[model samples]
Target: MDANDFVEIDGSYLEGGGQALRNALSLSCILGKPVRVVKIRANRPNPGLSHQHLHGLDLLRDITNADVVGNVLLSTKVEFTPRTILDNTYRVDTRTAASITLIYQMALPVLLFAGRSSRLIVSGGTNVAFAPPVEYMQQVLLPNLKRFGAGFELKVQQYGFYPRGKGTCQLDVQPVAKLNAGQFMDFGRINLVSGVGFCAGRLPVNIAIDMQQTAQREIHRLWPEQECTIETVKHSPEKTRDNGAGILMTANTTGGVVLGASALGKKRIDGHVLGSEASCQLAEYMRKEICVDDYMQDQLIIYMALAVGRSRMRTGRLTKHTRTAIHVAEQMTGVKFDVTVEPGGQTLVTCEGLGQLNKLI
Candidate 1:
């Protein structure tokens, strides 16, 4: 399928929410494919684009000079056709404090595909609900992507939490001619694993201290020899409306595989629970004996499609989000996908017809 062939997606098909829509839109922009989305998150309370979604859409429109028509509202369907993206530093501001990570997710793929390097400065919520915190991006995703020859730098100028969203981050991206595939089948030996707790806003300093102490003790119990650290940041009264905390754990493998897990603060949240949950999540990934996480599985599909060679990954589960991503990818590149479900609930995803698909796209 070339850029001329229009594709249609039932946005409410699976997971039945904005994520489906976001994935569809992002693929359209990255591949310069035109897409028509129907049943647009039909089950959602406010089914269409929220301010964050619209902001992401607007940023794409500005970057690719795409032709978009339809209501940029909650649950509304949209048709987008990306022309060619421009290469330069772009600035985007999400008026409402939406998750900046969502914006980064949508735009990063397109920027990577751009003919020239690009830089971006975005202002808005950096730490928000239902999204990866800034720490996750800096510590986990970006570093892992570097293994595949992806290189980018992110600088957080401020911490933005919920309600009162005022934060800033700058990104520098250097596009690569082609990506190198890597493997992570075994976690090797556990070198070090630790947890960090960060708190902001009206949060009491004692809360951060208590959470850190609790998390550190749990980490010590799990790996007695591992080292840990905790930190807290207090926000000026004028900068925040509420309290927030984030817990992150990083595990180093003997063979150099670095895996990260994280949990965020919520009302009545227990620090021990947060630490244990993050630790367990990392352990589960290691147990799966796979190289990629569920999130990376979905994120890397597009890169695999664009790569010059075959790429494969073994993941814990094929979530609806993963399925949606694969569907969108096939539509964009017309590359037939081979997905096998293992007996123990793991999934093997592979793409072999890359050379031919690259010609088509």
Candidate 2:
């Protein structure tokens, strides 16, 4: 690739986190455009590539057969030039308790574009901080991705929590020629609130049961008209490197809109408090006319921009994550976006997708 042909990205642009690199790498693979990034994660407390970030890049490199430089941990610069897209089952492990869901976020688009069915066995932290939990990926994100016309499935094989990360998940994807644009402007009525409460290792099974009951009690009190169901599961002690517990809540509304919130249990943290906190988060989200939550808002921007039609959604307050994603999308895909700050801290986001089809940009 010629120097002028490569897209130059400032790693410190916008929120300046690993997401900047994640979005850029996924887009580069999709667009088949080379990229040179400088000041990578420059604004983070531990700037540059971490283990999770490196594994994500390496996986992309494997799937795309890309030439990569500066992939070492804590490196501040990198270059990626994708050569081709391959469809095959691949395995990736963070080797520690890094965020596996974050790795999935990067691999999803690449696999979707591989033009053939693909399976991924991802291992790492399933319920780590600063990343969406695996339950959220299975319960919330996968359902919403179906609207984009992409066929994919996620199943958790084990629960991996923070510090000792060894969680595992299987993702199977069917290729599609092009992604259909999805509209999510309507959030009609929330009819069901469902969830999962689970624990691994030495925690008593009753801990999960108590959490589920607490969440059910609160949700029923708040929306008596809505149906609430929670399943409790306990994994064997051998399934995890450490003991952990948590709850994941999903609110499904009309028009295929889904919102999710999750809380991880810690030492000295009460299970009832964790369950109630998750319920409160869901209740607060229900108070707004949102098609998705702030996290989902950021997640959808890339897909919406890649589709061939207009995509519109309503979400909570404008976040730097969303803004950063919008910036990256415009730069990589030539999609135009309109963001309006609505009354009462809500936002309306509209995008005109380029409708890209085929393997070439």
Per-candidate Cα RMSD to the true structure, in Å, reads 3.3, 1.7
Among all candidates shown, the one with the greatest TM-score: 2
Deviating ranges (above 4 Å) for candidate 1: 1-4, 224-242, 343-345, 353-361
The sequence of per-residue lDDT tens digits that candidate 2 reaches over residues 1-361 is 6788878888898889987789989989988889888788888999999999999999999999999999899998999999888899999988898998899999998888886789999899988888998888888888888888876888888879878888999999887788888787788889789999988787888888888989999988987777899999888866674788899999998767899989889776577988998998888888885878767888888899888788888888877888888888888887899998887777888988989785632
Clashes (candidate 2): 2
Q: Pull out the clashing pairs in model 1.
A: 47-74, 47-75, 48-74, 48-75, 49-73, 49-74
Q: How do the residues 1-361 of candidate 1 rate in per-residue lDDT, one tens digit apiece? A: 3544778888777676666667777778766678887777677677777888788888888888988877466637788888877778998887567888888888886777677778888878887777877787887778677766787889887777677677888888776666666444555777766556666766676655666676667666765776766554455555455567777777677765667777877776566676666666766776665667765676677666666667777677787777877776776677867888889777788875344221112
For each candidate, the alpha-carbon lDDT, in order, equals: 0.72, 0.86
Candidate 2 wrongly placed segments (more than 4 Å): none
Name the weakest run of 10 consecutive residues (lDDT summed) in model 1.
352-361
TM-score of each model, paired residue for residue: 0.87, 0.95
